[model samples]
Target: MFATATRNFVDEVDRGGLLIPVRSLNDSIALLTVVVSQKGFWFWQKPKHVPTDFTLNDILTGDIPITPVLSETDFIKYNGIYGDSIQGSMDATFIHSNMNAAGKDSSKLELSFGSLKKDEVDVRQLLRDTKNSVLDMSHSLIKQTQKKRQVFGLVKERIVTSQPCSVTEEVQQADQCGGTLGFCGPKSPKVSLKDNGSLSKDSNVTMEIPTNTTIAYALIDLEVKHDGHYELCLMSNKGGFEVDSRTQKGLLGVTGAVSNNPDDVSRLAQELKDLSDHFQLLSALPASSKASLLKIVTDVTEDRAALGALQSVLNRMLVEKSANIADVSEAHKQSIQPVLEMLKESECGSVAETECSASLLSALHLITSALDELTHESLSALRACRSPAVLKITQLLVHCLCESGESPASATNVGVLSEDVLANLEHLFTSSDVNLQRDGDAATIQIKQLQKPGNRPLIMFIALRGLHSLAQGV
Candidate 1:
């Protein structure tokens, strides 16, 4: 359904900039190219009524008079939040109701060829999304800090144990005999959890033992080196598991999906819609139907609906990616011919002046951050980043702030690196790290930092080189 939907839409658009509507998914956008084949369209303006002389091809091809498709069709009704898919044609009156006031009256043609083109990521946002998701998982997999819990027990005095705990949505029971499903015994005191994509972050971002706490957790830690090597370490912690096994029971207690809440199948449908995937079709629907449809999209954990929705999101991302690629390829670099010439100057500004300058530094940091955002994961926006040029353009835009000879008032301050202070400006960087702990001044880093000078405004600079060094190879 995913591949076929794109192919069908692509065949209709050929290679045009217009976004057509489909009754298939919520708030969906389909394109119809000016193709080699031209035929009459079929469209209905009113209930069970066809245009006087209209053919199906005419409606599909947008050849019908604007009156019927716009005002006459139910698709154009201005009700907010939801409605049914109008007749085949876009309610010309409601080309994009989801848009803001500025874009409310804008037609699909306007959206396709509008100022939003810059939003396109040539390397394919979808691919970037995927990559970031993996990194997030990697980061999440990194073992969270499990501090030793101190307690006075009847059997042991002041027992300091590595309290084992797991975050989960629900748990199940084991069907076999001689097994407790939700909770576990001393021998099997580890809980297994699904990788809630969000789980990969600050292992400290924890959930209290909500509802279920009968099961144990199988503690595992994943470490990622700067070189990209990942090591997984598994161990049996000293403390018994802290878990909620209320839903499942057994020696090998059954459990519902543990996490990845954001992209939880239940949540993915809305996310897909946000990204203008097939879920966009829901936009044309009435508020209630749209809600029901979204419910169907989310409540899909083990069924074909889940698989179908996932496939649609992925496929739409790829198509949008390909489309973005074509866009970057066609952009005219010559449009800014003069600026290009300036960059070719024999002697450009000094690296520090250009990179760390009060004006240009923020831009540099922003672009770098954006690059990290782009490079973090392909799943982030497979539809947006389709080509290398896209990321290059993003870099260009970031550097463009500096190249323009005018400093932006607000620049990103990514504080200097500890290592940089260690090497070039040593005592200043680690003074607090080493001596503060010794001196019992844990607040030293706050006292001293990457501050720019007011007298010599031009000399104002953050130790970004420190950050760069720290992030090197990482």
Candidate 2:
């Protein structure tokens, strides 16, 4: 009866259009029986020979070859012999399992490939098509397996604990399956930005950004606009700011999908649009109102939204000169003392710290604008002020000018320094104890010590810019 059942199964497989060799079919049945009955024995023994010719007696007596299929070069050469029949069986099994697990009727399982005209068979094309079909089936099986695991509470924990499964083990499993699955896991979405700071829907950059993190970094290809150079910058709060020239732009883009929830998507879009609207509103404000806004901004210490608003306003004012020079100067005078105190305690913070960096940049802009507006008498008084805070502010202004050359479009308006400011800068240059030397059309300022070690080059670069500004003014 068992032999009759096996013969009936093989006959059914053949009738279903699978042309598995009769010997292979018998061997497969024998191997299945051995696997079911002596599972412990078979689990310990890695089958060296393909099951196509093995029998139950061979498995029971441990007479089967112990060679791995992958180690056999001849198996690869003759792969076409068994590949199609084996793959077809696997594909059918996978589909049936998936449909059954999904609570669908598997009785309707059918293999139809439309009508094929009688013609000379291209063996290579046939193999290629079969390989691709198998791959597609494998991918579908993997996805279904993941879904079933999630549904049945068999999902593996991604996080590590003191229990059985570790991250290392999970990684090893992925590595083992990567060749068959094409990848270890799903990839994240990536978005690119052009040099002009416009986001690109299609870009070559590949990086993943987490769903929860509001801030993301991207590589901007400024080649067309910035002398074929690229830049690395932060993207957050609906704006982008360059980090530094030293930071190369590579491996930048959104790494993951956005939220799938429609409400989350809608809310995010609305927030971004609101930020743009706020910037536009601030930019359109009259000069006097903007000056008042700057004053309010200086008083804001911890509110990120307020800081962003102020930064937007300041950026517009610097770029467009929308505010009156006198009004800006007055606002600068009111805010300069506080900003100077901040500078004394700290060096310029990272561009990532939107509040601190934006505030500092805005204050520097106001000071430069004020210096450009100052009368010679006022400038002389500024030189006479000679305080450490004053010196620090001067150094900060010069640094802004020097760094602005790297990104002229986004830099402060330091190019228009008045003769009065230039003379005062020259006085500060001559009086400073740091080594100051000229090397034919270029000035270098080197400082030996700084309150903050990281700020040494910052001060030196700014002082050098001040010297250059004075030279150009002269």
Candidate 3:
């Protein structure tokens, strides 16, 4: 019905336009202009009802002028739509009033395309935000780069230059005996106005530079050479050649991991195996023995961490039988001189040097308590003769002693070897003992007294006790 009515209205308006009252003509034309403009049809075709000179405000106010053609036809068909509505209305003025009222009501219906306010998309603020974010990212990247360098232990190389100097001279060997002396001739004393012990006017006085000022550099590079043999150079009151020095083999049993030699590694493995066996033996030993061992270990050092480390080293040297002995006797004495110097820094001033200190003997007894009585007697005999095995053991004992914070027990009886025990020890030296008498002759015991400084007797005693337990079937 609506389509039929719209078509009929369009046909009628095309034949003869609907007449509006002269009084309501301009209002009718303005209302029609608003409708046309609101429908967006005036964008393509400039409607005759809306004049080129008419602004949107004029149209909305119902004050725009109608073209002559639009006035003649009352109004164009408005694309043949809404024509019937206006034509069918009862009052022209009422229609105009209603249209204006509807337009005002529609003006209150605020339409928006997006939710964001105008200030939200401000270009200046957006640019500043973007710039700040970029700077932050660059700083973060720089920090990450520095972190990576630190993690990789990368050190930036820097050019190191010596201090600026006016003079330099290469040193010579003869200059070590004090450089050539220069004789200074007598000079006349300068006469000062203040020599009369009175105040005088201040005057700038220049200082004279010394004529003998010299800067010299000695080019000396001490290259340390490593050979298979360990050498300990010692200075004594007697002579350097007085003591017999032997070439050391393998690594210090406890420090074998640092050695590159395959033999050292093999020895270290064997030592470790022996250590494991010793622990197993300890576990199997009587409870009393274990208690005694524990007490001795606890008494050795108060520091638990140092105790653990010392226990491992001591076990390899004392508890574990068949330890791979390195000839670190003289080596230790040379190396530990610094430690002894440090020890001298203590309030005690210096540790008393004795041939066989009771404290050292007590420590040795505690370490070698696992050995049999017969072995102890044999060890005493070996000590008397100054055996290398005993010497090595003594070096290890000194190392362990240094590791301990407290002084060892001073109560001990390092008794001399009995004649009977020595006589009984002779059987091993006889041809009957195949191991000792390899050439089928009595083994001669060579006793060379080393004039080496320090307590030789103490070294022999400690090493003897340790060797008793450490040597296989001693």
Candidate 4:
């Protein structure tokens, strides 16, 4: 019976899975599968190609050719994470995208932008929801946790866990990281049982771990601090493995997080903190990869490991390529702008955005300037961003006037300084910011004794024509 079912499954998947093939860089079939993975599906191709403006999603809905196989690297990366890479059966119409030629095609983002934008919005919302959930959790501790020193270890296995946590129904909606309260004191946290029931004062947390952790557990002794319900978190490493109880599932990230027992806020606060960090990275990435990273962030966020992964991506982009913000689009620019504003408005010095504010935007401009600077140097194969970190770095660089940007020969810089520019900068001269150097040398501007004081004063920086605009406007 099982053998027959297996055969049926293979035949069904083979019939339905391979139905439509196309040249989709971001294979749309995968998108559909993400929503509907009731059965199983096979995706032989990977997204090795960075499409111009097009997406493969549109092609899958229509008739198209089979998308070529992905490069070995991408195939491994994309598959290692999202793809299940198993065989199963489901009868359905197969479609492959062809509308987009390998090199010549309109942008997919342009065609089905509604869906793409919606996908991004959904990611943003998911991030918000995850954060809010953690913050709303009570800031207390779990007075009691089963102390068998729960352990699991192996090279590959998630020590999954879920517990109840308490929280006030009235949660203050924060920025992208979402709702939160003032700093939660582990000694005493705000708890409301009616809102959260999965946790109790003596909440029981079930932690899952890989076998490697089992080895770590055997190694060293660790110290822990406790304040009321929240037990202190501990980390240690043994010979072949490591042990960590600070995971959200442990008592670190989830403050009031607990089972449905009504009141438990052990790791919830930490969970919210980590969540905020993930969005920090998200808001920094380019618009293109912002969507992809949004998906990954949403998944890892639930587990509270998003920051680790996000930081890895950031290191890759910033250190590896020295990529700046100007590389991405306005779409990405809009995405991070809010978080920056929120940090200042909320006066959350604790927030990382505070430190990254001006620098982030400046970096964006710097990169754009760099791109403008490098435009004439030389071009190479383009590796598009696939993560939020990549998106943020690229987006920040688009605004600069660098060699990589518009060239003098593109048209003409004859009207080098436009009237508009002059008008905007006029205040610089009149702002009472004495143009003086500490050394008493001509500070802001160098002025010469023109024939006489009443005569037109000749300034070193501004020309008479440039001055005319500023003076006349005043």
Candidate 5:
């Protein structure tokens, strides 16, 4: 019954002109019959009458005749012989085996009849081995996929951690850049003493100043002392002074002052004392004094009364040994030093001009007379003054004495007979016949007596002419 059905199916395929020859169809049916009968006998339950001796070798050796029912013309009409197609399908199986072997191992297989026979090939066993290899390869591929997933997860975690670190670093860099641009920073307070002689007790005094602001000028009023315990403090974000603080106390102590040098303080004290004495003497003098002297005193005293007040405050602080007293004195000196320099420049060449020489000389003489009556302290201060005004006066007086060949004994006591005053006198007379020397509290000038009796009259005449010119200017 099976043979008859298979023959009928082949005949139908040939009649339909499917290009499948009956012989090749019969060979395929015989091979399928062999595999089903041998491997799947339980499923079919083969009848006793059906043949069970079929094999692939019997079919290949032509022990089973597979006659083509279709004519050659019919086969050509469908599409040439279909035997090539069957042969190509068989070649594909060998090609698949070669590819699998290449991937599985390095050993080469010779494609020869002897090698094939010598191997005693088993088709079922080969198929089973190939299936097991495929299963093992699939299992290994699944494990490799899982490992890749773990590595990807680690890389993602690292990236997540690194992002915040990079952001933090960027924020720090931005803050530094802002500082350079002068933004977002604390500023120092500018403290000024109030009229009530007290600083505001607020610790964080915020001045409307920008960061890194510089001081243009600082005006400190030391006139009002609080019970002889005056204290001034400056506070700032960067750094500033704090009164009565440990740091400040350390700096103001005796050892601290000595270490910091007190020469500048001493010099400033001397200057202030000299100015105070001069003002005091002038203030004591009656307003009915000489016009030129009164004018000079009024002009300086009216415009500079603050200096005198500051001087008094400084003297008290020095005597009491106040903290940072030198610092206060130095500040005052800096404020007044420029004015003194200007005065010195103004006084130079003041009496050199023939037009204003006499008036300038008279004004200088009045100053000299005032200086001469000053106390020892005042005298010391005046001696320290190196203004050209004082020196020029000495020069003019000496010049007059030389021209007249007469000693004005009254002028010799016009100022303190200090070394500086005597030096000026000597300098003025160095090129003249007059010889100057300090005599007790006065400077004496003596005319040289030349030995040429015949030239004495000529010398007298020149002296008279100089005196006449000076008198005319007066």
Candidate 6:
């Protein structure tokens, strides 16, 4: 019956069973049966002629043809750990021998193979030795084959624990968990169930290794001092400042054009004017004052008073035909003339014009005298009337000059301004008080000189012009 069934086994066999055939013998006309007892088989056949070493590129480009020694089905069958009747038969024989050796001297029992006494051995002892040998060989094979697999990416197995611990103990625990913890207080944190849960009076906390914890455990060890619901906030001493790279690039381009072509200077002035007009409402609000200096300046541009004062000064410079104001060249004067005309038209012609022509004219005389002769006496006189307004207007004017690439250039011609003057000028837009220094350098003589009630605008103007020259080169 076995031989008859084996004959037709090729046609009736299932691929998912233990009796699967190897690739070489699968479709042969002759009855070729090969039983594989081991998990894997070595390739016994070698190539007739070994090829020369070739680059991986050759294989990728199909220059080298690849012929696999075994198909997928055959490889899987050969490398599979499948159990057969051999192991079961060995176990059954051992069990039968042990049963027979019961209540007898097992060493005295002998076994003969093929009627040969020389090949005989004690049955019980031989069975025990065979079982031990098989077990030892299997253990050795498993140990030799075992390997520690390496995996990529963030696959670290974390065991989160909510164990109650003191602040000192938490430091060690946090280190153990890769420092995924915030600040902790002196006492063990009270585990609150509700938003307004009552605090625990008990000081003693049971300490034990936590068995289970999820990833949703709290990182912050909060201790509510007197809470109805403790509010947590993150604060920073440094102000939040951001620059619009696109707008900055556009301003840079405009400045470059203004330096080469004086007519383009009016466009620069117009942009500044438009910015002020658009953000006047938004910048005047209380919240806007608390915003970062860059944000406020970019949003607010210059106030109405500043624009009015600047327009007045530019008009006088044009009418008087002054060779230059400080380091402003004749070319710069030609540039200023168009901007002045635009400001003048905006001041008087438009319905949106808020500042009366009278006030602007009045402010013009004071500003004109200050610019004409930059003496302490003349500047002091101008500073006495609307001191805060004067500083604001001056800062805006300097900012406009810098933005327009027409700022006062220095004697050095290489740099914008002296370090002291540059530092002092930065405070005007950055701080609430122009006199204040962020770097604690207000006590320095240079800073003190620039911070004087009247010297603020003159020093800043010097810095502004230098910045303009430097910007052009940039």
The most accurate candidate by lDDT is 2
Poorest lDDT segment (10 consecutive residues) of candidate 1:
151-160
TM-score versus the correct structure, for each prediction: 0.14, 0.17, 0.14, 0.15, 0.15, 0.16
How displaced is residue 297 in candidate 1, in Å?
15
Question: Which candidate's TM-score is highest?
Answer: 2
Q: Model 3 over residues 6-79: C-alpha lDDT tens digits?
A: 22322333322221111111222221121111111111111111112221233121233322111111122121
What lDDT does the true structure give each of the candidates? 0.20, 0.25, 0.23, 0.21, 0.25, 0.23
lDDT of 4 by residue, 1-474 (tens): 111111222232332221121221132222112110010000111111111222222212224322322211110000000110111111111121111101111110000001000011122332233231211112211111112221111111011111221111111111111122121111223322231122211122222221111100001111122322111122421111022446523322111112221011222223323323323533444332332223322222221112222322233233343333354345444333333333233322454764554334333222222121111101010111112222222122211112232112222221222233222222222221112111221112211221212111111011111111111211
Give candidate 1 regions above 4 Å deviation.
Answer: 2-8, 17-21, 25-474
Q: Which one wins by lDDT: 5 or 6?
A: 5
Model 1 / residue 267 / CA error / Å: 36
> Which structure is stronger by lDDT: 1 or 3?
3
What are the RMSDs of all candidates, in order?
Answer: 32.7, 33.9, 52.3, 30.6, 58.4, 41.5
- Per-residue lDDT tens digits of candidate 6, residues 274-351? 434323332232221112211211111112223223433444443443323454435444333433443344324343
Q: Which ten residues in a row are the worst by lDDT in model 5?
A: 151-160
Q: Give the clash count for each candidate.
A: 100, 9, 0, 92, 0, 2
Q: lDDT at 373 for candidate 3?
A: 15
TM-score of 4: 0.15
Candidate 6 has which clashing residue pairs, if any?
Answer: 407-465, 408-465
Model 5 spans with C-alpha error above 4 angstroms: 1-389, 392-396, 399-404, 414-417, 431-433, 449-474
- Deviation in angstroms for 305 in model 1? 11
The TM-score of candidate 1 is: 0.14
lDDT of 2 by residue, 202-250 (tens): 1121222121111101111110111212221123211111222466642
